[model samples]
Target: MRLNNSKKAKFFYFLSSLILMTLFLGAAFFVLEQYRFYILGWKSVLLIIIPALLALIFIFSGRQIFEYDSDGEALNFRNRNVLTFFNKPVRDEFPKYKLLQYEFVNILIFKRLYITISSKKNNLIILKYDVSYLTGKELKDLKFSLSKVIKANQEREKNS
Candidate 1:
């Protein structure tokens, strides 16, 4: 199974752009009005501050685009932010047998995936991914795929 949330990411970018534009335009208009009327009241400040805060919340709540590929004997995962300059993209790949456990977490606007895997040095490594942009169906599919791999790994371990 291969899954990527490119469509959702595009929509997110569009919405964020609209909000940011609105914020900028509001601030510009407020400044112009203040200059014309010489008014420095709380109401005018509130008008600008509210939208700025909302835009900040909307943008900060946003998550990176996530991609998953479970082909051949390895599972590959990738996470890249919309603003590429902020941080480097994360990529991970490991064989099925190395998978130990997987979990999903949902808290308000934040959704995340946690995966535990065995390293070559026999140490356990935990990885986290933002899944806020994934749809319900996509999340379900991801859970099913990870569960299948975990089950298979458990069976193989028992047999061994």
Candidate 2:
């Protein structure tokens, strides 16, 4: 199974851009008014601050784009931010037999996936991915796929 949240990421970017543009325009208007009246009022400050805060929240929450692929013998995962210039993308690939455990964590509006795998040197490596924008169905599917792999690994271990 291969899954990517390109659509959701695009929509999120669009909404964030809209909010940011609104914040900038509102700030500009406030600045113009302030220049004319020389009056600093609480309401005006809030009018600018509220939208700016909202924009920041939206940008931070929707930064990551998640992708999962499990077609071959190895499982592949990619996590990249919407702002490509800021940070490097994270990519992980390990054979199915290397998977040790998987976990999902939900904190308020954020959702994360954690996977532990065994390295060639017999060390454990943990990888984390942001899955906040994935729909309920998509999340369920991903969980099911990972669970199948873990089960297979357990059975193989028992036989060995």
Candidate 3:
């Protein structure tokens, strides 16, 4: 049974990437037709082929490597099949507190010391060991929620 309610996870970059890929494909075709002889050379092939292959990968899969589980018994997860490259878990510390809500953002639990991409749901995408994930807006939303949770914790502490 799923604990967190599923909602449409916003991947803001999807449209931009689609547009970019479309443009690149158009340009590549145009180049092939207009400058066909020039593009056949090694240098042109290297410049266009590598990025095109990468773009195709991105277009098909999207960019994500981890999933977020705020309510799970285990607060963090690393895929066993994935080769460990960072030499450290993404979060700065093991997340403490019941995670109420999370959007695409950078999460810093006080105890842990590695950065992590906040997961939205099961199948969308999960980013792992990714330092460059999260946007400014997502970060702001997360900070606001975290501040509220911290304040509530402080109040409970004082009362007890």
Candidate 4:
């Protein structure tokens, strides 16, 4: 199964970048004009450059969403970064039957679904959206499918 973002969701990301860019440019102008004499230090340049680059990247790169695919043996997680720090792709094989599961819990105090992969030890992927919008049957079906994955992994480990 695949999950794709709706049109509204895509548009919201674009709208957010526009707002942030406006605020960032306003601050940049203030620093360059009003406080240039006092804050002419290297620290000022460092701060401004970092945020400006971040804003530019966000404006250019639309929001990235994660979806799972089961064709290949390994789990794939992809994201872009400011620096190419982790250039090598992760190729280690996790337990064969591990499944991604989500629990509607307070993930670090926020009301988001805590998504994790369950094996002998739980490998947390990340906090996803809340379960408030999901129907009862949808939630049940999702949980059931995920449990099967966990069960398969456990069996594989036992045989090994």
Worst window of 10 by summed lDDT in candidate 4: 82-91
Q: Lowest summed lDDT over 10 consecutive residues: which window, candidate 2?
A: 55-64
In terms of lDDT, the poorest run of 10 residues in model 1 is 55-64
| Cα deviation of 90, candidate 4, in Å | 9.7
Count of backbone collisions in candidate 2: 0
Q: State the lDDT of candidate 2 residue by residue for 1-160, as single tens digits.
A: 9989876667766776788788998898788767776566656676688888886676556446889999989999998877676467888887999999999998877788989999999999998888887889999999999999999999999999
Residue-wise C-alpha lDDT for candidate 3, range 5-85, written one tens digit per residue: 112123424543564576587567657755765554545545456666555544333223333343433455332112233
Each model's TM-score? 0.86, 0.88, 0.34, 0.37
Model 4 over residues 68-108: C-alpha lDDT tens digits? 33335654332222223323222223433554554665333
User: Relative to the true structure, how large is the alpha-carbon lDDT of every model?
Assistant: 0.83, 0.83, 0.40, 0.47
How should the candidates be ordered by TM-score, best one leading? 2, 1, 4, 3
- Clashing residue pairs in candidate 1 (N, C-alpha, C atoms within 3 angstroms): none
Question: Who is ahead in TM-score, 2 or 3?
Answer: 2
User: What does the lDDT read for residue 152 in candidate 3?
Assistant: 61
- Model 4 C-alpha lDDT versus the unseen true structure: 0.47
Measure candidate 3: CA RMSD.
11.0
Backbone clashes per model, in order? 0, 0, 14, 0
Q: Write the per-residue lDDT of candidate 1 for residues 11-102, one digit (tens) a residue.
A: 76777778778888889878876878657655677658878987766655545689999988999999877766546778999899999998
Q: Which stretches of candidate 1 lie over 4 Å from their true place?
A: 38-40
